[model samples]
Target: WNKLPLAVQTTESLAGSNLWDVPTSHLHPSTNFSSKLFWEPQCQTQLRHLQDRTRITATIPPRLDGHWVSSRCEVRAGPEFLTRSYIFYPTRLFKAFQHYYCDSNCHVPAYSLIIQGKLRLRQASWITHGATEAEHNLQKVTLVIHNQWAAHRLETRLPSSCLRLGSGVQLVPSKLYELFNAKAKRDCLGALHFSMMELDLLRLEIQYHPLHQPSKELFLGDVHTDQNQRAHYRPTGYQQPLQNTMHHIHPCPVCALMYQSSEQSPPILPPSWSIPLNLNGHWISQRCEARPAVLFLTRLFVFNEEHHTWEGTYHHYSDPMCNHRTFTLVASGHYARMEPSSKVQGATELVFKVIRAKVTMFEQTMLQMLNSSEEGSCGQAGGWEPGAEQDITWTAGCGMLGILLPHKEYELFKMEKDHKNRSLLLIGERPTDGSSPDRPVKRPTSFQTPMVQCSPDTAVPQHYSSRSDVSTGPEVSSAIIHHSVFSIFLIVN
Candidate 1:
């Protein structure tokens, strides 16, 4: 008896320590000590013996109640010291619900249990003792559980480590376990498996398991505290009461009809044109003869190709300065394409009708009139009333011309090479003789002609010829007979 370990003395010393206190009522009759301390080791031994006979009941912690994912895993064959690395891919855990058991008083926390997540083994390798060769390779082993428990284990097989018992199982120090718990917030849970490498060492394997379902289930037990400071448990299955199984809710007919209508309806597409006109720009005409002096007609043409309509404003300057010595005209009308004339092959012409035309004074001109006391002097000069219709002829090829009011024409000889520039030269002109409207007087051939290079202060020299013999005949009129004789040049800044 003396050689035997003093279990009774050890328990008495334990009770005397402040770490744990034993109640007098729980003392053993023979030893006069707490029965809990005396029988604890024996009970544990019996539990281990029972665990060997039957599979241990795995308990889950509330913290490990989510999904996990894994990319790599370590595989060790039996008896072999070598560990091989392989891809674990991913796994899923769904419908994880945890519950904690409580005493009758429900005061002390007891075992925690969880039923969630499916365990699937992708590959497993087993090697023979003293051999590096693998004995067998198992693949696609799925452990299906309608409701399973989670076992908490503290791995301490590593050198200089502490073991922790959680949820009725021993937990070991493992890097894989730490990683699994670290990502709990992201709902990703990891699984770490251990195989015996030696008598005292363990080989750790890690794999990632993601959550399969988004829905979560939570179970809570009602608790009450008594005067003795002990907790009592009231079991409850689910937070919400289940509905009647006989009746099933059906979807609304109106909602189904609306969804069907929305699904079957086609989306609206925008209207488009094949040959959209690029006429929304500014066009300036060459300096030519006008009412009072040689002037340049600068027009800003704004066209809506979608609407097939155009509006523009034109400024006629007697001098290139355009300071107070300019006339302004506003007009709007619809335009259409005309058939190409045989006389000028490949030339595209547009028929423009001035549905509304109003001549207004330029700001500089108005200001000059106010300053010079010549207000009424420019009142009736070259100004037209609103809503007045005018017919003009537009010929476009090597050059563009807008023949306005019979003999008066605005010619734009220099067009910007870039279609985006939207600029053209305006040359104002008038017929020298009575010929067909299409066969009006031609421009001078010489580029240095005074009419072609008219300056602001310099008067055009009359000696410079303004006409060229480019066939002044009635045949040109017949070629363009199908088109309306209207033209306007627009210049956009």
Candidate 2:
């Protein structure tokens, strides 16, 4: 290990110490422990496989707890390796609920809103009966789903659980609008609004949005069907009972009715590397016994939420007469076409390319923002004293949204203004997408000991504890909120 690349070896043994009460790391050319390590040729094979990209599709197998399980495959130069990775399905996550299978690869945007002011809804929950003035104030009602991936897309509505002021009396729609329009208090809002809301609210208004894509479009299909089929499935015609979870533009019920009445058939799959191999899709999965099951060699049908129907796709592998083709309805109603090994390989490549492109764009955007901020500061008359000015650029991928850029060799992020001391996470920038544009870089500066104050949202008693805690009752037009110092600071600074 010591004789290998310096960076690789250093990463391998970062836990041990060479001296008392202190840890030590050796350089690549260092001979201190060269003789102690032995290199193995067999390990190289496994390492190479680890570096290759493997694609896994989420599926429900009857053999398991119905949670999502993934079947992954990777093609190597010498031999092919197929593996099964366990995944937690979205539907199974909820208690006693049938969850919709969302496309893991699809970029679903989400956002969250934190209420910094007094919550009138808290008291409104007590009104479980008749329609009253509070129930009529629709403008004050705000129901936003806080999906972390996309924060900008928010839906204004009332949660079902909200206690109505009166039975059969609906709250005024205007109140819902006021809730979201409420001022940003202490920047405490970091919430998620799911993709479903974006599609339903904006599909008619905007040309395209994420939720508008039918589940079938993302499922097994050709390029033409994938691009244009979303329109065939309309939200207005769906028969499925509309619910918060059913925010996805639904499929046509007429098609679903036809599918329900049609004869059931088994899925025909492409060739498999070996016997007993498993194949799967976003919502379906199949396992073959001996010579890749012939049942999987033909056509398979999948449920389309957009058109409220079922659609079938044909899958084939070369074998002359195609005698290997056979269809088996292992499970009634839900079926997936057996995918060709070659097609699977192609899908994996496309997924990787999309992810890489998005990441690259994120990095570039962050760098530009950081550099622009610094340039604006440097353009000032004093130009910045040497070493007195500092800039740090960084990226935050977890707990927060959006990719961050490097600032002064370090990345920075502003946390949700809440109980946690509003400190920033500083991480150094590594290689991202490509080279960043040059800018007037600022030098690092020492900060005199600065006192940290608790943010207003955090200083006050914690309001939201869990998803269940959200109010579902009579509407409260507005809340009386104390002025948060941070809110003032953010505006003034």
Candidate 3:
């Protein structure tokens, strides 16, 4: 026992310290306390397995007095149980000690798994959807399992105020994609629902309960009676099953082409009716070791404004041994094109915008007059049109209209399902002040006052033409216009 591994020795001594087998002598300060692993290694193995698998199916041993720790005894009889069926009561000291051990084992990965026969959240029950396994980066001294509640139950239903739909606020389509991605990572059910009036909150939570009914067990832990009962982790508020819950799972090109060739398919419309401007692309790259990811691609979709419809696809791959890549489609114009490709990386804009009539007219007039070109080389699409089909379109549907709001409200953003659920949130009515003609308007969060467009009675470029025109009624000139050369020229005059 004295020659055993230091960790094993210490653990055994701690467990056996109260025993009468110790020699009757003044306790030696130099006694070998490190040889502690002599007791059953079952506890160690179970702890290690629970940590690695992200699940708790450990077998509990009998106590030294030949009795069991009530709640833990039943867990040993049958592991496949729920609520009070399986519990892990690691003392706070044990977790604190694990911190140093985890640091020393810098490269090791940590996983926590909780498996049961049936899982229930809200009114829905999932018989086969418990987490199979999870892996995490262990380099950090303390790791917080965010969205831990996902394994236990879904988020609480948000209050009625959160269901702000078609209130002129837009929910960025990209943000909804992200919410789904987080759901997959934590193995929690990610649900979003809205039908003009009903709503659901995006929720993430985690917890552990005993295997057996605690009615027979002695009381333990300092229970807080004054705590909010409503906050005690329960699913509330039901939603109708989504008609097209799998909205974004796309078929491969082969399948898409086969379907297209087999049927008399309609011509595919672009993202919007008007040609897009500000065509640009950007890239981001990151890497992780022994840690959970903070970002990943979750969903992709294409909005056909003409048809007022959306077709999309989804992917959920989150394993520590796997590599991740994300491709984003972003543009500003009448119709924002979400270009389709299997591998969406490193693809440049192959085609330029089509030529507008005004820009074409300007170019043709210059050529007919035989004047040297001043616009250098005009793209196929040239010249800006005020009120012409701007590249992006904002129709007045409930869900479509909410696309402009901040991402936090994605779960609350919903369109009417009875009719075609098109992009309800569309980009319409440029800042009418005529200041910075093509600039986009900024949306405010709950943190600040909302910005509104100038009313019909308010004057535009005329009233805001000079410093004297500044109004004290919480009205500030558009930031983009304030920095524009046109604004400076008008002010100087």
Poorest 10 consecutive residues by lDDT, candidate 2: 349-358
Which candidate ranks first by TM-score, i.e. highest? 1
**Candidate closest to the true structure, highest lDDT:** 1
Off by over 4 Å in 1: 1-277, 281-293, 362-493
TM per candidate comes to 0.22, 0.15, 0.15
Give me candidate 2's TM-score against the actual structure. Answer: 0.15
Error of 2 at 249 (Å): 33
lDDT score for candidate 3 against the true structure: 0.17
Question: What TM value does model 1 have?
Answer: 0.22
Model 1 steric clash total: 40
Q: Write the per-residue lDDT of candidate 3 for residues 1-493, one digit (tens) a residue.
A: 2332222111001122321112111112222211111212332232233223222111111001111111110000001110111122222011111100011111111111212111111211111011111111211111111132321221243222232334544332112211212223432211222111111111111112345211111111111111232123121111111111111112112222212210112112112211222211111111111111111112222233332222211111121111221111121112233342112111111111211111111112222321231232221123322212111112111121112211110100111111122112111111112222122112110010011111111110111000111111111122321222121111000
The C-alpha local distance difference test score for the whole of candidate 1 amounts to 0.22
Looking at candidate 3, the ten consecutive residues that score lowest on lDDT are 73-82
